[model samples]
Target chain A: MSLNFCFLGAGNLATHLSKSLKEKGFNIIQVYSKTNKSAKTLADVLNSDYTTSPAKITINADVYFVALKDAVFDEVLSKINLENKLVVHCSGSLPVSVLSAYSDKTGVFYPLQTFSKQRDVDFHKIPVFVEANSEEIQNKLIQIAEKISDSVTVLESAKRKYLHIAAVFACNFVNHFYTISAEILKTKDIPFEVLQPLILETALKVQEIEPEKAQTGPAVRFDENIISDHLNEIKDLKNYAELYNSISKSIFEHHQNLK
Target chain B: MSLNFCFLGAGNLATHLSKSLKEKGFNIIQVYSKTNKSAKTLADVLNSDYTTSPAKITINADVYFVALKDAVFDEVLSKINLENKLVVHCSGSLPVSVLSAYSDKTGVFYPLQTFSKQRDVDFHKIPVFVEANSEEIQNKLIQIAEKISDSVTVLESAKRKYLHIAAVFACNFVNHFYTISAEILKTKDIPFEVLQPLILETALKVQEIEPEKAQTGPAVRFDENIISDHLNEIKDLKNYAELYNSISKSIFEHHQNLK
Candidate 1:
């Protein structure tokens, strides 16, 4: 029989995961949030029971997923009794061990993608990283993940932590660079759309070429004139200027060493 | 009468531009490169005259496009007399003044996109930033630019320089981050392909939403624990670890100030 799932949060990840799972014919038995409105909103879509209080969570559900923020994971987990049932947390950085005391079947169900409430992600393309304490649990987790995603991997906590960090660099930090670039254009009255094509192509290139081989720009070329000119342009924006100098220096040094 | 074009370089930009112009029915009269073989390769494709000598550039062509690197622009322009014909350089940072002494009618025909020999970019979607010394020259340049691309803008050299700098940040520097992330993943035997969906989606999100609003990850939320943990993961790679801390701190501070 298919295991019934209970979501312990109704934030972006929880909503996206629950909706995708529901579409795949998984039974989402309950949806829990700190606020009733948020829980009810997703529960209606999942056709599941809703609750704001942990005490109201359905113990009968075979699996429970805590998808809350990292800071609240401990406090939230402390309130729920897993009764040796399968429990997992949908966090990228958090270790699977966080749920070990509550259930022997504790594991991780991290979907490695930037989730936005407004955007509907195609889970088929998203890589779901599953981790568990035992082989049986790991196999079961991978099976469930495969239902929603074409790419699923069993990652250990140590490697998963590094993967999450690597993601922060690739996704989060890269987006911040976009934010900085947009700010630069705004000062000159140039629309952000001008940078959109370049941004898209840059990412697309990496798919075919290795990032080290694909690297370009003033930094890689060690073009001091262009770098100096760029520094002059951002002199007033001290922090951003420092960032440009630092990153450029690092890239230059990296390539210099490679040569 | 349709403008007859002469290309001064047979590199990525020259090849792409000439091909697109040729397809759009522009007469490519000549193709010049630093070497005869390189010149012949593109010239045969465009069905234009090929030459390695700048002195051999066809004077009959309406406009001459100096598409070489900025380092060679001065040297190449010095070698040839444009014969008071319309001349332009396809450089982002170089000002229109670089061509002013070369010809009475000088302008800039910078296509604002990274050009790679391996990639075929759609000029129709690429924005061509046009600038010239006079209204007549500007109008002619705009007409030629419009033949291939739907998006064309008249930007002064001053604004164009900043735009180029911004491109370096958005495209070049952003690609470097991908390099760094890929490096981190390689240490753990994780394939860079795993991060492809996240990278593409991160860029996709900014299309509809402002980047400042679209920013995600532990840094934006200021999760110091994860930040510290990431720093730990990169402890051996000093430069990358420093970059991680700096960018994360910047994003954290940027969001903190906004709040």
Candidate 2:
């Protein structure tokens, strides 16, 4: 029989994960959220019941997946009575120990990709990191994770934190550069779409070459003339200039150390 | 009839553009570089004659493409006698006027995409930015550019400079984040490939949504606990810490302004 899942949140991550699980033949039995609209919205899509209160969460499901914000994990989990039912939280930074008080069969099921409600990601391509307190639970979680994703690994909490940090640099910080690029182009009345191909290629290049080997531009070459020219052009934008200087210095120093 | 071309500085940009033009049925008649090996390497691929000496560049070709380093533009252009032939430099930051001293039909044929010799990019999708001294030259360049690229724009030198700066932020600086991400993951003995999906998706997200709206992570949310935890974890790495704080503040300020 397919293991039934009761989701404890209906945010971007929960909405996507639950929908993906449902599509993969697992039963998303119930949805729970602090807000009625979000809970109902996702539940309606999954054809599952939903409740805005954590105390009202169904105990019939074999597995409970907590997808709450990092801050409310404690408060939300405290109210639920899982009766030692298997539980997992989909968080990159948070540890499995966070769920130890709530259930003995606790694990982590972190899908290492950015999730937006509007965006539909191919879960099969996403790297899902799973960890549990016991081998039985770990295997059980991995079995389910493998069904939805082709790349599933058992990553411990100690290393998982670093993975999350690495993701911040790769995704969040990289996207910040995209935002900065758009702002710079806006000043010249140029559309952000022009930078899209360059942006996509930059990401694509690293897949083939190591990021260190793939480094280009003034900073990597330490071309002071062009670097100074760019600095002067964006000097009015204090934050961007600072970033340009700092990141350029970092790239230069990184290469220097490499030598 | 196809226009004959002579390429100067057989570097990444020159090699890719020349090969792309050759594939599109344009005749590459000659290749010139400071190093004989570099010149002959590209020349052999195109089945064209090559010369290391700038003066030895063939004047038989209707178009002379200057893809030399920014610092060597004047030194090399002074040596090559293009006379009244159309001379176009493929540079992002350099102004079109830089070629005016060399020839009356000078123009800029800047492709707004990152190029590496090892990587084969789809030229048809790459946006090519063109600029020239006259409307006639501009039209001629645009026609040639259109044959190679579907998206061709006639942008002036002033606006093109900003576009180059934007590319730096979008490609060069963004690539630095990938390097940093790899370094962070190295500490935990985690493979860089784990972050590949996240990096690619981050770039992909901007294509479907505005980067400002697509932004995620602790920085955008001002999640103090997770931010502080991450800062403490990477505090030993002074430069990474500084970048984390700086970029986080920028993201915070940016979103704050939007409200």
Candidate 3:
């Protein structure tokens, strides 16, 4: 059966995901956004109707994706009238049941990766996370998502929450660490490009070893000399000094606990 | 003036470096290593004569690169009887004056990047850290390094020591981190390729921002909720748990201090 999709937000994820779904033989009947123009722009591209108001979504679609800010889920659901039509919110942090306010047949279609407006996502490679209200909805959602991605998974809300938290550690936190490293190199008049290979190699390592097992540094080695030298180097930057000290200490302490 | 060349060690570094220098228009007259076979192999490649003994190095290159390990510097220098032959060691941790016993014309050409036999360096981008016995050697070393790389700097041993420490944080430590992240993904049946972009962008952020300014995470944000959840998720992995707690605490503490 050809599934139909109506997306509520014509943002990065919406624009990319809708086009991908449409290309995968799904019928995208409508697009809606807070801004009328953004909705119309996406709707025109998807060959669907564009509307400024969620209340104006007159036609029924098999699946409606509400890709909104985390803070506004409740308000947005309250404004929508999906009636018993299947509606899914694309969020990692929000619970699957959060869409129950708008429609009983609701679920989640969380894509577990970072989305930048400029970077076009390869939906085929991206892991589409699906969580539906019932086994029937799950089957449909899974099939629809699988059409767009080979890496589709039926993750429960609880497990999805765990994955989201893990993503925070693996993605957001990791990013900040890189930023700090670049900052240090910049102050020394070193080009940041010098660290590119090192960075690429780091991420690639996880493919072979567990994160816990793969850990290294003065912290893991208990190399006091290098640790002290690092401490001295970042002394002027108190935050960085503390970061270096604490992470190093944690690495050593973690290893000691193992023994 | 075209500088005459001498290589004090034809070990891995000296072999690669001498080849690179020869390509950069410097004459590599002789190759020396503890093993005559290693020396002969490299010497044959360079068309330079081979010697098993540093003391037997009759032909002098303009710059003699002592690529011997840290433990062997004194032993290697004691045998190499030479006048001012512009002796240098390619070690970031060692002082340029370590060659003081052998010659007044001494400098250090420590490339501030990891070099593994499998990975060939882009010499043009590699940070070549240089220091010399005096200002004259300093200028000469800088020009020589500049011939190979634009990212050349004159750092006395003290600054180079700091740079070495920084390199640990950015490279060695960073690589271990990738191992951890890769493990985290793999345990969930997720491929490491999914995490590559995030890892790359994390490092890229540092090129434009200070590591301190670019730092992000639940730790940096002081989000107690996510931290507690993540801590619980890895509770069975106690060593990793402790590491998580400590690093998170450190990042939180850094933010608290900042505020």
Candidate 4:
């Protein structure tokens, strides 16, 4: 049977998955977003119908995915029509059970990847993390997820929460670290391009080895000479200097703790 | 003129650069390290004379790259012959004038990257940041460095110091963030592979946009809901929890300073 799918949000993640699933021969029934333009734009790509309102959305599709921001998930779901359709949310941060009152077979179909409107994502490589309330829905979610990605991970809500937190640490926190580096470089009139190779290398290394094992730094070696020199170097960047010192101190303390 | 490159210390950086330079047709005249194996391994690859004793490294070279540890730069320079053999050190933290007493042709040939034996570097994009006592040595260092790398940045000592400090923030500090993510993933028994795509995308984004404009997370928006949830989620790793909170606070404060 050609399963009919309806998306309740047409954000970056929703747009991407919609396009992918459509290409895989799933019938994308309709798309919903805050604005009609966005919904129509994404629905046009999937060759599906579009709706601007949660209340206007019909219960014709077998699947409905809520792809709103995490903070508004409850408020957004409250307005949705989740009848016999298997309702789900594509959020990594929230659990699937948040849709329990709306539908008997609500679940999660979270794709663990950073989505941006600018970048083109390869859905085949992205690990699809899935979960559901019932066995039938779980199997259906897994089957649908496997159509888009080879790497399908059926995780419990608890584990998915951990993964989301880990993503906050890895992706979001790491971006802040880069912002710090770029800020310093801008002040020095040093072109930020120089940091690119090192950034790529650091990320690649972590993929292959444990971060603790891959660690290489002045702080790790307890190279006080370099740390002191570095401290003096960042003297003009008052806040940045404090950051440098605190991080080195923390890393040094972590190293000591391990020892 | 066949410039005989003599490594004053066959450390990780020294060994990697020596191999790259050797492959590029620059002669590594001698290899010297505190440990015998360190010198021997690099010397074998470089096809050069090797010695553990710095005093025995008597061969004349165009550039004597003192790739010693930061703490032992002075001690190592004292032990080695540095009358006027284009004495330079591969240290980002050390001042160019550290070798001023020993030679007029003093400079730095600091490769701005973290090198490990496991990772084979493609020198094409690696930026070689250099500083020298004289214009002639600076020019010569530039020429020599350009042979291997497409990116050669001729920076004064002040700018070089700034770049070095920025690198610590970029490479070293960014890596600590990676470790934190890995720890979070491990505690949850989630394979780090789940976060790989996210990690790659996060790093790649900065290269295309100004880091300030590219930054996204709960801290920037001051989203207390997610921040509070993350605080509770990270209750087990207290140190890391504090780290996340501390940096987020700093980042938020810094962004305010910008406005």
Candidate 5:
């Protein structure tokens, strides 16, 4: 029989991950959340029992998956007892040590992709990074990860933290630029759809070419005329102008070092 | 007969645009660049004559496509005389007046996509923005643009400049973030490939959802603890930390405004 799993937290990441696991034939036996609505919503989708109270969390499951916010790990985990069952937290930044105090068999199962509750992602393509306190638990976690992902690696907490930071730069910060682009286009009465092709192409280019060699625009060329013009246009918007100047200077310096 | 074209720059954009037009059955009659290697290289591919001297540019082509650098437009355009022939420039930031002095009929034919000569792009899907001095030239430019692209819009110079700025943020600066991500990953002995899925998903997410609504990360939540930890970790890198703080503050303020 497939291993029984219990989920702690039912946010975007938990919802997507639990549904994906269920689709792969694993049994998600229960879900626990601080909020009843979120718990019940995701639990209903998985056909699993759910409780808003941490003390009511099921203890018989073979594995426990904690997907809470980093800030609440202690308060949430302290209330539940898993009794040495394999426990995994799906976080990009938090270390496995956060779960070690609560269970002897603890590990991390982090999928390196952004998740939205409304969107469905192919887990087979997402890289899942795993880490555990013992080899047995590590292998057990890897087996589960390999079921869902084509690429699974045993990453330590040290390297995982940097990976998380790099993700912030690549995904979170990059999305902010998209937001800025949308705001700029909005001022001109242009639809954001016009930028979709360029944005997609830009990301696609880096897949084949090194990002350093793939770089373009006034900053790379250090074209002061166009750069100054762009700055002047957005100078009224203090934060944007500052970001434009800072990134431009960074790009110029980076290229200069390349030469 | 198809239109005869003379390309006045042999850079990435010129090579791609000229080759795309040739593939569509247009006749590329000549190629010109300040450097003979660039001129001859693209000319050899197109089976066209080439010249390094601006004075030697062919004046008899039906359309003169000038794709030179923005700063050198005056110095280059002043050297070629197109008489009453249609002159079109492929620049995002330049005004239509830049080509007006060289021909009685001048227009702008800017493709809103990034280009690299090593990669082939499907121009049929790329949006082509056109502007001209008159309705006759505008319609003529739009017809040519439509032949290559499914989406063609006649936008004024005033609005095109803003579009260009948005592209810089979306394509140029966004690529810079990719570079930074690679650098951060390198320090930890991690390949940049690990971030590719996240990077691509971030771009793809904006296609179906508004960027403001799609935004995620510690910044949007204003998670002080995680933000401070990340800042401390990258404090040694002056520029990266500055950018981290700046963009985080911007994201925080932006989401706060929505509330």
Candidate 6:
């Protein structure tokens, strides 16, 4: 039997997820966004009804995916009447319990990858994390997720939150380091392209070895002179200097613990 | 005319470089290391003479690449004499002046990539930073580098030092974040493979867009609540807690500056 989906937010995640699902032969009954323009844009792509109000959400869908911003999740849940429909929120940090306020068939369907509207994501490679208040809903969500992705797993709320936090550190925080590196290179008229190979290899190394075992650089080797030199170079920038100090000290201490 | 090469150290960088240059038809005439075991191993692979003592370094080579550890670079350089033969140090932090101490024909041939003995680096893609005491040797070093890598540039010592520091942040410090994330996932029985795709994409994204613009996360969005929650979750590990706070604060402040 074909399942129907209603996306509550027509943002990055919503657009990607709905399109992937629709392409996989699922019916997208409706799309809702805080703004009508976004709702219409995404709904037009999926050939689904578009709305800016939660009250106008199609009550006929098998699943209602509330893919809104984290801050507005609670407020938006209050305005919906999911009742018996399986309502899932595609948020990493939020729990499935948030959907229980509006629907008995509450669940979570968080895709464990960063999504950019400008970039097309391969659903087969993305890990869709599913969790729910009941096994029936959990199984249904898992079935739907498995259709789109090769990696589908049921992660509980507790682990999911930590996973989300880790994602922030691994994806978001790591990108900031690249930004800092780019900023540093720009000062000397060096293009960031020079560092691209190094950055790619750094991530690639972990695939073949444990990250702790794969760790390299002056800090891992405890080369205090290079550390001091790097610190001295960035001393003019207060935050970067502090960031360098703290992360280097942490790496030094982590290696010490391993020893 | 094809240049003759002498590698002053049989370490990771030396091994990869010697192999690449030799494959490119540059004759590696001699390989030297403090330990005869490593020297013999690398020399045998390159079909070159091996020695433990720097005094035994062949004077026949056109260029001598000092690829020793930073702590041992000065001591090793003191024991070698090339006179008119060009000398270069494969170090990011050290200036060309270090090589000038032993020979007037001094230069820098720093390959800005992290190498592991077990993995083969594609020399064509590696960025080789070249510098020299004289334009003649500088152009010569660039010529040698260009033979191995498609991307070669002349970068002076001052800018090179900052580039190296930025590299540490981009490659080394960022790897530490992966280590931390791996550690966190291990505690919950989640395999690090779950985060591998995200890690690769995070690095790949910057190849197309600016890192600052590609940045996404709680800190980038200034989601204080999620940031606080993540901090609270990591508070038990003193160093990780501090690292989280320091980097998160730095990212928040950096984004604010751009606004």
Q: Sort all candidates by lDDT, best to worst.
A: 2, 5, 1, 6, 4, 3
Q: lDDT value for candidate 4?
A: 0.81
Better of 2 and 3 by TM-score: 2
For model 1, how does the per-residue alpha-carbon lDDT over B100-219 read when each residue is reduced to its tens digit?
A: 777889999988887777778899989999999999999989988998999999999999988998888888889888888888888999999999999999989988888888888888
Q: Candidate 6, overall lDDT?
A: 0.86
User: Which residue pairs collide, candidate 1?
Assistant: none
TM-score for chain B in model 3: 0.85
lDDT of 4 by residue, B22-122 (tens): 88888888888889888888888888888887678764777788888767767667776667679988877778988887777799898988877777878
lDDT per residue for candidate 3 within B127-246, as digits (tens), equals 687888789988988889899887777777876765665566665556545555555655676565655545555555545554556565557656566577677877875356765675
Q: What is the overall TM-score of model 1 with all chains considered together?
A: 0.95
lDDT of each: 0.87, 0.90, 0.70, 0.81, 0.89, 0.86
Query: Please, what are the lDDT tens digits per residue for candidate 5 over residues B1-259?
Result: 3789999899988998898889889999999999999999999999999999888888879998988888887777788777889999987878899776778899999999988766788988899999999999999888888888999999998889889889998999999999998998898999999989899999999989998888888899787887888888888874898899999999999999999
- Model 6 chain A: which ten-residue window has the lowest total lDDT? A74-83
Which one is best on DockQ? 5
List clashing residue pairs in candidate 5.
Answer: none
Task: Report clashes for each candidate as comma-separated counts.
Answer: 0, 0, 15, 0, 0, 0
lDDT of 6 by residue, A1-259 (tens): 5888888888778889999999999999998898989999998899888888767767788888888877887777677667788888887887778676777888899898877877888989998899999998889888888999999999998899889978988998899999999999998898999999999988888778778887778888888888898888888876788888878888889999988
Interface RMSD of 4: 1.6
DockQ, per model, reads 0.79, 0.84, 0.25, 0.69, 0.85, 0.81
TM-score of chain A of 1: 0.96
lDDT of 4 by residue, A154-253 (tens): 9998888788778877877778878878777888788888988888887777777766666777888888877887777667765667777777877777
lDDT of 2 by residue, B1-259 (tens): 5789999889888998999899989999999899989999999999999998877878799998988888888877788777889999988888888888889898999999888878998999999999999999999999999988999999988899899888988998888889999999999999999999999999999989999999889888888888898888999974898899899999999999998
Cand. 5: chain B TM-score:
0.97
TM-score pick, better of 2 and 4? 2
- For A1-259, candidate 3 gives per-residue lDDT tens digits of 7777788888777888999988888889988788988888888889998888766764577777888665556655676567878888887666787777778898889876655544466777677889888999999888888888887778887767656655666666566555566567667675656666555554545544445564544566576655676687778964678767756665666568678
Better of 1 and 4 by DockQ: 1
lDDT of 5 by residue, A1-259 (tens): 3899999999888998899999999999999999999999999999999998878888889999989887887887788776778889988888899887888899999999999876789989999999999998899889999999999999999899889888989998999999999999889899999999999999999888899898888898778888888888888864798899999999999999999
Q: Which ranges of candidate 3 are over 4 A from the true structure?
A: A1-61, A66-72, A92-107, A118-125, A129-150, A153-166, A186-224, A246-259, B1-62, B66-79, B91-102, B153-166, B186-193, B201-224, B239-259
